[model samples]
Target: MKMKGLFLAGLLWMAATGMQARGMEHFIDELASQQEVTRVSLGTAAMALGSMFTDTYGVKHIDVLCLEHCSDEVRTKFGQAIADLHDPDFEPLVSHSENGERTKIFVKIKDEMIREMVICHVDDEVAVVRLKGKIKPSDIEQVIQDHGSDR
Candidate 1:
């Protein structure tokens, strides 16, 4: 009886892991085919592990890609890809475009708390970032404040 229980538990764990891997691979595969991609950075699992010690939250998967000479049409498609990943029930927090450049930020909330954030930017370069966990409004405020100070 003990061996049977162990075998069933192991099988369940393996199946769950496989499904998680497939979901992660789907996005990576989708982005791999795009051309003019100059640089790519992937830190999904790595960042999750590091987040435990940093007192940071709401960052799950991180992928950044820079593309040069990207056309307007391609940029639109990139934005759509990120938009499609968002939860349709709640509207994104920020969606703005100017001078041929675009930026969109999405957030998911549960129990009146921010749970996830996805940010995308396109223009001379394209970047897509996905963060999963908990986030607060003040975090956003501080980031924007610090960014303005840098300039």
Candidate 2:
């Protein structure tokens, strides 16, 4: 009985770990299923094309969700969802507001590499983007610099 209990506990731990690993992706998918949201998922091939112009070489997958002209209830729900993501695992890397629009960037890091990045933008239109891969902070900094120079 002791051995069986230990085995079951191990299985449960593994299951929980796996779920946490994909938590961001699952959240994005859930939002995508809503009638007011539009989702776009980009795979490796698309990311490869994107890397040509930006510093996306380390990004393996990207999920984008856009909610436009949504009801106030929907907006409140989305805002709460984003707020719930501000846990120890996901650190807020950047947050700013401009022209009535607010944007927040969060990153989850493991072993000194960023494993996932989530960008949430709230305004007249809500947009959320998730990027998953092993990325260095410098890679993100370079992307920001490159884009900033273009403006």
Candidate 3:
């Protein structure tokens, strides 16, 4: 028997465009692709390890890391990025899956024009891809509000 996959192509979204630059240099290697990051940096170590599932992913703390490889600037920038995350922007990208599971990701490009980011996967692995893009708690809240869901 043969099987197909779920694929999403050419998705572009717009954000509020009212955020401050939070230069964060997180994300080391791509467990997946370039536009899609396979790792993130939360607050605690557990959160980092817990960042393997793409789906059901979220961080209760202000700090997090998806991997063990982090530079001091990246670490400091991560904290500062979170602290500086004022408002986040959303630019839809390509999403797809082949294992019968759907792969969803949202890339944060010019958040405050100082940070950049890529979305790896969601609802599959313990992963929350953040590519050093400027983002605020409210921005995340906005997504939850829009999606009618929360963490």
- RMSD per prediction, one decimal? 9.0, 4.2, 18.2
Of 2 and 3, the candidate ahead on TM-score is 2
- List, residue by residue over 57-131, the lDDT tens digit for candidate 3: 344323222422444444344333332333244444446666643443444545344233444332223234544
Tens-place lDDT per residue, model 2, 1-151, is 9999999999999988886766665667778888878778999899888888876748889888888856778877877677566455788988888897788898999998999899998887789988899999887787778677885
What TM-score quantifies how close candidate 2 is to the native fold?
Answer: 0.72
Query: What is the number of residue pairs that collide in model 3?
Result: 29
TM-score for each of the candidates? 0.56, 0.72, 0.26
Worst 10 residues of 2 by lDDT: 79-88
Weakest lDDT window of 10 consecutive positions for candidate 3: 10-19
lDDT of 1: 0.65
Q: Please report, as a residue range, the 10-residue window in candidate 1 with the lowest summed lDDT.
A: 82-91
Candidate 1 lDDT, tens digit per residue, 22-103? Answer: 5423544665567765544446677767877774545555556554556777756766665554444344888889997788
Q: Which structure is stronger by TM-score: 1 or 2?
A: 2
TM-score result, candidate 3: 0.26
lDDT accuracy of residue 101 in candidate 1: 77
- Which regions in candidate 3 have their CA more than 4 angstroms from the true location? 1-88, 111-114, 122-124, 133-151
Ranking by TM-score: 2, 1, 3
Clashing pairs in 2: none
